[model samples]
Target chain A: MIDIFTKFSGQLFVGLGWTILSSVIALFFSLIIGTVFAIMEVVPSKIARFIGRAYVEILRNIPLLVITMFFYLVIPKYVMKINGFTAGTIGLTLYTSAFIAETIRSGIQSVSGGQMEGARSTGMTYWQAMRYIILPQAFKIVIPPLGNQFVNLVKNSSVLAFVAGFDLMYQANSIASTTFDQINSYLVVGVLYLIITLPLSYYMQYLEKKLA
Target chain B: MSMIEFHDVQKYYGHFHALHDINLEIDEGETVVLIGPSGSGKSTLVRTVNGLETIQKGQLIVNGHDLSDPKTNLNILRSDVGMVFQHFNLYKNKDVLENIMLAPRIVSHIPEEENKKRAMELLEMVGLEKWAHNMPSQISGGQKQRVAIARTLAMRPKLILYDEPTSALDPEMIDDVLQVIKKVTNESGMTSLIVTHEMGFAKEVANRVIFMDQGQIVEDENSASFFEQPKTVRAQQFLSKIISH
Candidate 1:
C-alpha cells in the first residue's frame, strides 16, 4: 500500500497536465458553440429558434459517456479516423454548449422588454439591439451560471477514459489496472482533479466579484 | 392632407376591445393632448402612431407612412415618430450622454462629434447638461424622464409621443419635467401627442384636448373648450373626477 501511494504521488503530476489540456480545449470550443447556439435561439425566425432548441434538447438529455462513445466508436467506423482526445474534447464541447445555451438564453430573457423597444424605437434593427444593448446586459446576468458550466466541463472530461483518451482519468485507469492499486491510483487522480478545479472555481469567484 | 390621421382604428387585446372605431387627425405642427381614465386607451392611441403597438383594424397614417399596412417599414416610421415611455426606460446600462447619443450615432449614422454636439445641445435644452455622464440608475425619476426626452429629441423626429410623461414623477419633480416639455414644444414646433393626467399641464400646453372613454373619442375640442364646457357626459364625469382629486 505504501509503495503504491509513493509511486502514484509522482505520477499524479503527469495526470494533472492531461487534465489541464482537456479543460482548455473543452472550454474554448464550448464557448464558441454556446455563443452560436445562444444567438440562434434568440433569432426572429421560427426555423432558427427550432434548430437551436433541437440541438440543446438532444445534447442535454444524452449522457456524456454516450456522446463520447458516439464520437469515439461510431464516427471512426463510418466516417474518418480520429484519436480519443479529439473525440472526448468534441463530446465535452457539445455537452457543455447545451447547458451554456440554456444559461445564456435565460439571461437574455431577463433583460427588460422595454430596452428592446427603446432600441428598436430608435430605428435599430433587431440584431443591432441584441448585439449592443441586450447581449451586454445578458452577459452580466449569465456570468455565474456560465462559470458553473465551465467547472463542470472540466470534471466531465473524465468521460474521455471510457474511450482510451489520454486524459487524467485514462492515466489513472491504466495505473490502477497494472499496479492492482485502484484506491491509491484514483486518490491521486482525485487530487489532480482538485488541483485543476479548485483554481478554476476561485477564478470564477474572482470574476464574479470584479464584474459585480 | 393631415400630417397624422387615425381613421376607424380599433385594437383588441384577447377580446378586451381596448380601442374602438377611433377617428382623428392632427395637422402639421399641431400638439394634441389625450386625457382619460386609466383604461381609456389614451396611451395605446399615441403608441399606434409610432407603430409601437399595432392597430387591429383601421388606417393610421403618420408622417406619410400607412401604419395599418403590414408592408410599412416601422423602423423608418419610428425614426420619424419618437416615443417617451411612462417609466422613462432610459438604458440603465448607459449614461445619460450615451442614452442621448446612441440613436443618432447608430440609427441616423451621424458622425461621432456631430452626434455628441447634438446630444449635448438636447441635454442642455432639458437642463441635464451637468449629469451627462451619470447612469440612469443614479438619476432621479424626473432627471431620467428629462434624459429620455433628450434621447427622443436627438433622433430629430418629426413628432414626439409622450405617454404619461409626468405621471410616474414625484409631485415636486413633475413641474420640472413638464417645464422642459413645454419649452421643447414651444421652441421646436415639433408636433406632439401627449397622454397625461396632468389636466393643468394639458390646459397650459395643448393646442387641442381629446377625451377618451372605453376606447372611443367622446370629445375632441380646443383645450379651453374641453375644460370649460365638456360636450359629452363621459367627458364631464372624467373631468369632475380628475379635478376633484
Candidate 2:
C-alpha cells in the first residue's frame, strides 16, 4: 500500500479530483431536477403529475450502468457525440434524481394538509402557498433522506469505471491492473470514499438536530 | 348589503350530502354562531363562503363574488374572508410575527414596514407582543390559537370564520382564546361565522345563533331567545345534552 501511494500518488490524486468534480456536478443538477419533478408530481394538474410519476418510475427501475451505457454508446451513434465522463455524470444525475424526487414527494405529502388550507384561506394562490409554506417545510422533512441519497450518489459514481470515466473507481482499476496490487488499490479508493461520506453523514445529523 | 348569501346551495361528497339547500344570508357586521352535534355540516357551510369547499348547486355569493361560477376568483374572495381552523394552523415554520405578516405582505402587497407594524399591533391585541419571535411549537395551545387569530386579523378581512377554533385546546386554555376572539370580533364589528360547542361564548359574542342538524339548518334565532327557549325539539335536546356534559 505504501509503495502504491508513493509511486502512483500523482495518478491517484488526479482520479480523486475527477471523482469529486463529477460527484459535485451530479449532486447539483440532480437536486434541481428532483425538486422540480417532485413538485410536478404533487401539482393539481393530472397531466403534470402523470409525467412526473412516469419519469420517476422509469428511471428508478432501470439499472444505473444501463443508463450510462445508453448515454455512452447509443447517444453518440445517433444524436450527439459525448465523452465517457459526460455520459457517466448525466447518467448519475438522472438516476439519483428519481430517488430524490420520491423522497421529496413523500416529504411534501407528509406535511399536514391543514398548512395548505391555512395558506390558501389567507388568499394565497396555490403556487404561492406551495412556494412559501409547503416547500420550506417539506425540505426540512426531507433533509436526512436527501443526505442519504447524496452519499449513495457519491458511491454510485463508481459506475463510471465501466465507461472509463476516470473517477476514483476507474483509477483504482487502472492502478490495480498495472501494479497487480488489487487489494491495496481498492482499499485506498475505499478510504477516499469514506472521507467524502462520513462528514456528509455527520453534517446531516447536525442539520436534523438543528432543525428539530 | 349582505356580506354572504347562500341561495339553495348544495354540496355532496360522492353520494353523501354534506350541505343541503343552505339558503342563508349574513348581513354586514353581523356575528353568527353555528352549533350542532358532530357531522352536522356547520363546518361545510362556513367553508363554502371562501370557496375552500365547493358547492354542487345554487348560487353562493360572498363579498359580491359568485362562488358557484367557475370564473370567480376564489383567491380574491379569500383575501377579504379569513378562516381559523380547529387545529390553530399557524405556519409552523414561521415565527409569530412572520405568521401574522405573511398574508398581508404576499396577498395584499402591504409594504414591509407597514406589515410589520400592523402585525405587531395584532400581536399586542392578542396579548402576545412579547412572543413575536416565538415559533408556533414554542407556544401553549391557547397562545397558538391567539396567534392564529392575530394572523387572521392582520389581513384586515371583512369576514372571519372560526371552525371549532378552541375544540383542540385544553380546558384551562379555552377561556383565554375565547376572550381574545370576543375582543377582536366585538371591537372590529367584522362579520363572523363561528362553529363551536361553547354555548356560553356563543351567548356572549353572537347576536344570532344558527343550529344545524344533519346538513340542514334546524333553527336560526337571536342568541338570547334561543338560549332561553330553543324552538326545535332537536335544538332543545342538543342544548340539554351539551349543558349536562
Candidate 3:
C-alpha cells in the first residue's frame, strides 16, 4: 500500500483535482437548473409544468452512464467536439439536477400555503411571492435532503472513470491494476470520498439549525 | 360609490357549491360585519371581493375593478383591497416591520425611507413598534394578527377585509386584536368588511351585519336591528345558537 502511494501520489492528486472540479461544476449548474425546473413544475402555466416535468423525468430515468456516453460519443461525432471531462460533468449536472428539482419541489410544497397567500394578498406578483417568501422557506426545509443529493453527486462523479475523465475512481483503478494492490487502492479512495461528503452533511446540518 | 358589488355571484369548488347567488353591495366608508356558523361561505364572499376566489357566474366589482373580466389585473386590485386572514398569515421569513414594509415597497414602489417611516407608524398604531425587528414566530398570536393589520394598512388600501381576524387567537388575546381592528377602522374610515363570530365586537364596529348560512345570505340588516330582532327564522336560530354558546 505504501509503495503504491509513493509511486502514484502525483497521479492520485491530479485525479483528485479533476474529481473536485467536476463535482463543483456539476453542483453549481445543477442547483440553478434544478431550482428553475422546480419553479416551473409549480408555476400556474401548463406549458411550463409540462416542459419541467418532461425534463426532470427524462433525465432522471435515463442511466447516468448512458447519458454521459451520449454526450461523449454521439454529440462530439455529430454536433460538436467535446472532451471526456466536459461530457461527464454535463451528464452529472443534468442527472443531479433532476433529483435536486424533486427535492426542492417537495420542499416548496411543504411550506405552508399561507405563506404564498399572505404575499399574494399583499399585491406582490407570483414571482415576487415565490422569490421573497416561498423559496427562502423552502430552501431551509430542504437543506438535509439537498445535502444528501450533493454527497451523491460527488460519489456519482465516479461515472467519469468509464469515459476516461481521469477522476479519482479512474486513478484508483489504474493504480490497483499496475501495483496489484486493489484492496488498498480502493480503500484509500473510499476514505477520500468520505472526506468530501462528511463535511458537506455536517455543514447542511449546521445550516438547518442556524435557520431554525 | 360602492367599493364592492357582487351580483348573482356563484362559486363552485368542482362539484361543491361554495357560494350561491351572492348578490351584495358595499358602499364606501361602510363597515360591514359578516357573521355565520363555520363553513357558511362568509370567508369565501370576502375573498371573492379581492379576487382571491374567482366567481364562476356573475359580476364582481371591487374598487371599480371588474373582477369577472380576464383583462382586469388582480394584483392592481389587490393592492387597493387588503385582506386579513384568520391565521394572521404574517410572512414567516420577515420580521414585523419588514412584513409591513414589503408590499408597499414592492407593489407600490414606495420610496424605502418613506416606506420605513410609514411602516413604523403603522406598527406604532398597532402597538407593535417595540417588536419591529422580531420575526412572526417570536410574537404572540394576537400580536401577529395586529402586525398583519399593520401590514395591510401599510398599503393604505381603499378597502380592507378581515376574514375572521380573531378566530385563531386565544380567548384572552381576542379582545386586544378586536380593539386594534376597531381603532384602525374607526380612524382610517376605510371601507371595512369584517367576518367575525364576536357578536359584541360586531355590534360595536359594524353599521351593517350580514348573516349567512349554507352558502347563502339569510339576513342583511343594520347591526342594531339585526342584533335586536333577527328577521329570518334561520337567522334567529343561528343567533340564538351563538348566544347560547
RMSD of each: 2.0, 1.2, 1.1
DockQ of each: 0.73, 0.87, 0.84
List ranges where model 2 is wrong by over 4 Å: none
lDDT of 3 by residue, A1-212 (tens): 66666778899889889999999999999999999999999999999999999999999999999999999999999999999999999999999999999999999999999898889998999999999999998998899899899999999999999889999999999988987889999987887788888898899889878877
| lDDT tens digits, residue span A56-79, model 1 | 999999999899899998999999
Model 3 chain A: ten consecutive residues of lowest lDDT:
A1-10
> What is candidate 1's CAPRI-style docking category based on DockQ?
medium
Cα lDDT, all candidates: 0.88, 0.94, 0.93
Between prediction 1 and prediction 3, the one with superior TM-score is: 3
Tens-digit lDDT track for model 2 on B1-245? 89999899899999999998888999999999999999999989998888888899999989999999999999999989999999988898999999999999989999999999999988888899999998899999999999889889888899999999999999999999999889988899999999999999999999999999999999999999999999999999999999999
Q: How high is the DockQ of candidate 2?
A: 0.87
Global fold similarity of model 3 (TM-score):
0.98
lDDT of 1 at B170: 89
TM-score of 1: 0.95
Pick by DockQ: which candidate is best?
2
What lDDT does candidate 2 reach at residue A84?
Answer: 94
